[model samples]
Target chain A: MTGQFPDDLPAGQPEQSATHPLPAYVPPPGDSPPPDPRTAYAPTALIDLSIPRRTHPASPVVLAARIVPAVYLGMLLPLGGLWEDIGLIPAFGAAIATILIALVAAGFGWWSWKKLTYYLDADGDLRVDSGIFQRQARRLQLSRLQSVDAVSPLIARLLGFVEVRIEVAGAGDSRAVLRYLTKSQAEDLRTTILAKAEQRTKSEDATSADVDGGEYDPAAPPNPANLANQMDGELLARVPMGRLLGSLLLRTTTVTLFILTVLFILFTIRTQGVASLAVAVVTGGVPLFAIISEFFTYSNFTLSRTRDGLRLRNGLLQTQTRTVPVGRIQAVEIVAPLLWRRFGWVRVQLTVAGVGGEGQETGRAVLLPVAPRDEALAIIEQVMPGVAVDDLPWVSAPRRARWREPFQWPFLAWAATDQVIATRTGRITRRISFAPHARNQSVRVMQGPWQRALRLATVAFDVAPGPVSLSALQVDLPTARGLADAQADRARLARLHQA
Target chain B: MTSHVHEVDAAFAPPQENWVRVSPKLITARRITLVLGSLLEVAVIVALWLIPGIPTWIAIAATAVFVAVFVWAWWLIGRRVRSYGYAERETDLLVVSGILIRRLVIVPYGRMQMVDLTAGPIDRWLGIATVQLHTAAATTDAAIPGLPPDDAAALRDRLAARGEERSAGM
Candidate 1:
């Protein structure tokens, strides 16, 4: 039955070459291959919920490593000047104090690690019990599980451990982090959680089948074995190192910095003296840091399709594996910078419901950092499934709107299909955002004083916060009203159809 | 002015002219708050005037500005209060407000996560309350203020029931 899905594969395929690496699932040393689908629910040794599990024993070392550098720098740098004034004995005492602090932090870390234990409850809810004094116990419902990501910071990677982050729907703090698990253990845990979550979702769907008018078949439950073989999923897109670097360099900020640096050098030479270059350094440093960070974050970015959802693996210093479940994406945006357009490149960003607040440095919202136009469209199609990007009945903003956004007016357009509402804006960067009608939270029509005078309005389709922002700017008043109303109606109908 | 009103009506028209206008007492409530705030500002300026070496003209000018602003706000309050209206459609709730930046927000019942009913001291005294609809997206700012307590409660119950029936997962 699992073979019907072509992407699903049998367990334990040989690792792919290093050039295009895949997350090869290596089962625990003692356990055999995953059991057959027809068998009753049997917890494997790797994912035995009856036993409470602890992270790697080196968890204390990892915690100490994270804290020691901050302590050393914070104590040593400020005390360096004071040490000259205070004397050698006190300086040595200060150094000893810093070591004591580090030791205390490590001790606390060890205590917490020893105390912390996580297990899956009978209802398939993940319960994490921790805190030395408070004894905090958190139960995360599997039914609301949005995504499960395995993240490895540089030090954690060196120590052969990964942090499994589970994000559930609702609230900013709706996330669970299982820190410092072995790489294989993290993989197994992610697979088990996702499979269980899928089963829970299927069961819920079955229960709601009456409301859904028998749209969901209760008989066809997902095969956990197939989901465990996520390693063998087909690769959809992989960003090359060269393209990632090129895209970073071609950013508008990089260009502006380059121009500023040249002007600064020329001015200095003309003055025939070393001028105050504080302004130049301050201006150039931020973008340079941003570019370097972006490069490190997006290097070796690979996106693949799994039975559970779409899996994204990226990062140089801190490798992160994020799975965005099927139909979980709320919105998608494709951005093509002016410079990148020459190379036929664009970047794809997504707005998943609960996968937010992880910060852009993790590239959580970035679907593709840089891909050719066609490849970008193909990836968007996969993410949004059934929406045609190239072909849409686009309606450009009325001619009067040009007065408001003179340069961007020509590019300002909006399109509404039965499935998605898309808006295009920006003259230089050229951004096109698509929000599925079913996922739209609300519709808004707004008009500023100037827009009122110009008889123009802007319509916005709201979704859960991420990178994608969909709005039709400077549209004619009647058209904007019509669009908003039609969009609301479409959203209502789409929600009904989905139910 | 009539033409402007017509344009606004055309732009933000609900299915019909069935918009349930907010309480008229909202204007009085807002004006009282505005006057109190202005009086506080004037008091601060008068206190600064009592300071040694402070110019009397500065305090007088500040007080005059506050008076002008207070009068302007008082004049605008009624219009702004009148502009605030909400319409309950079959599947969504429409909230239209703001004079300078006219906005009409339509939040589908299925997307509503929570319905909050709140009453400030002045609102409680005036027998009015605010009903705020929260969706998954924070940008969905749909708050209908200055509804009579009974109406607010009834609206909250109706919205809650509809939200439950059409509840969709984020």
Candidate 2:
């Protein structure tokens, strides 16, 4: 509250600090020999003892997972060029060849288990070396390595191993992926590489020479910004059941299934029962689909903090993993949908510097599926420090509501518009309730220009991700404009920094 | 070599023969080659139709469309490949490109994450290669196109060295 950075944050993870201290990083030795072939170019830490170790064959079960690829390739080959009319013997032979190729590939898949060995050089590069038939040694100098992505695949999940992929600079999908390693091994590998890079850097320059030779300036610790470790709670919001379920039903496949089920039941029934069953299907479908949709939308959603980047892993059938380094996030925007406006919730997205569109791996990266209204501003504060979002107090706006009550009917003719709660092609969709929940409290105001001139205010209250009807209080419009303007000004102050 | 300098690292010096620079001229030539290649493709399609059991009108329509598309494509591809330009700035590297949406990407010197120097068949044929610059952030990545082999390698080496230099805070 003193407007000064606290020496200590609210709290940081004890385990995170003990395991990931910045000062002691060293790289593991990989394939490259340590004879100083390219001069004393990189530091000695990277030139560890064991780089050219033997390739450990993959497990047979690893190949079993590859059945998906084999089956896909098997179907594609005959259609692609293999089974063409080069005579029945050749065609039949081609089919046989396809199976043989699949078998050989499956065997190779089992055999090509890989471990990428890495270490940090004194100059601050995380060098990785790995390959099977043809060994490829890739050096991602510390500065160029963007994100260190760690994931647990279905196999790794059960086997207690984690796969790590390094996102490095340059083009054409250059990444060093280590398929199977213990969780501890990955953490060590990450530490060693970064540490070596930092050390090598220290070894450079006349001033650095004195520092590396060993002098500890407590005030200017090696990584003075190491205190940034205290910054946590990057999580913006949690996606609740209502919005998640609503979105699922909006998908084409789920709706199509419902339509199909309706047709199937109607035909199966007799004439008298047909109409009743048709009504029953429609009545049951909305709630059933909503529940099913919620189940589909957020089956296993978890966002976690890594040392150098943010890791997002999600999916129902095919799990996808994406890691974004702090440096790459461009613009962050929080959008509150009409449903969420009812709950005062928002969805956060970060614009990333890249050609690809949004995905776990793409731009305007989704930060949180959902979060509370007030928490949105707080999350933005930690991730992008420079953007200043003001916490201001202001008036509210008036909304056009359709009503037939004695006082409402005549007032509806000259209603203050532009305050839409839930609109379908410009038509309002009424809701059951609009009162704010006991746990969730927020100040709301709405205004139109004319209403603002008359000092009118319309207050809307809701506790979930949808507009709550019959709970808005109409006052002067000027109060609504003042409040809306203040909020807009606060949003304008936020920025999503460029890459 | 200029003498009198003491304790110089011989590795810093350039070789006796100079490396040819890849110019915009070859980019134009590549575009021309594309036109020729398209013509040859259309000719093959026409040739197939001209053979004894095929219809002439189908071949005519196909060749007509191919030629039309090729004619329209020449200007587009020429301008796009022509617009691709790369230069090393004091602070970082710049790659400016685009036919429709102009883009001038500036990768800061200190932020460069990796440089991958590559030469495929077409590059070897043209006596040129490419350098891809990647960053920790996926979005800020760029490729320096069409440098003569030695120049590309030298650029990579320089960038790698500079990358290390800056990262080391030197």
Best by lDDT: 1
DockQ of each: 0.41, 0.01
Candidate 1 chain B least-lDDT 10 residues: B1-10
**Best TM-score among the predictions, by candidate number:** 1
Fnat for each predicted structure, in order: 0.66, 0.00
Model 1, A2-102: lDDT tens digits are 11112222331222222221123344667744543322122342377657888878888787776665777777777777766766655575677678987
- Per-candidate Cα lDDT values, in order, are 0.76, 0.46
* Candidate 2 lDDT over residue span A213-325, tens digit each: 12212333343113223212133334555555554453344556567666657665745466667655765576576656555545454454433345554554334445554
| Recovery fraction of native interface contacts for candidate 2 | 0.00
Interface RMSD of each: 3.0, 25.2
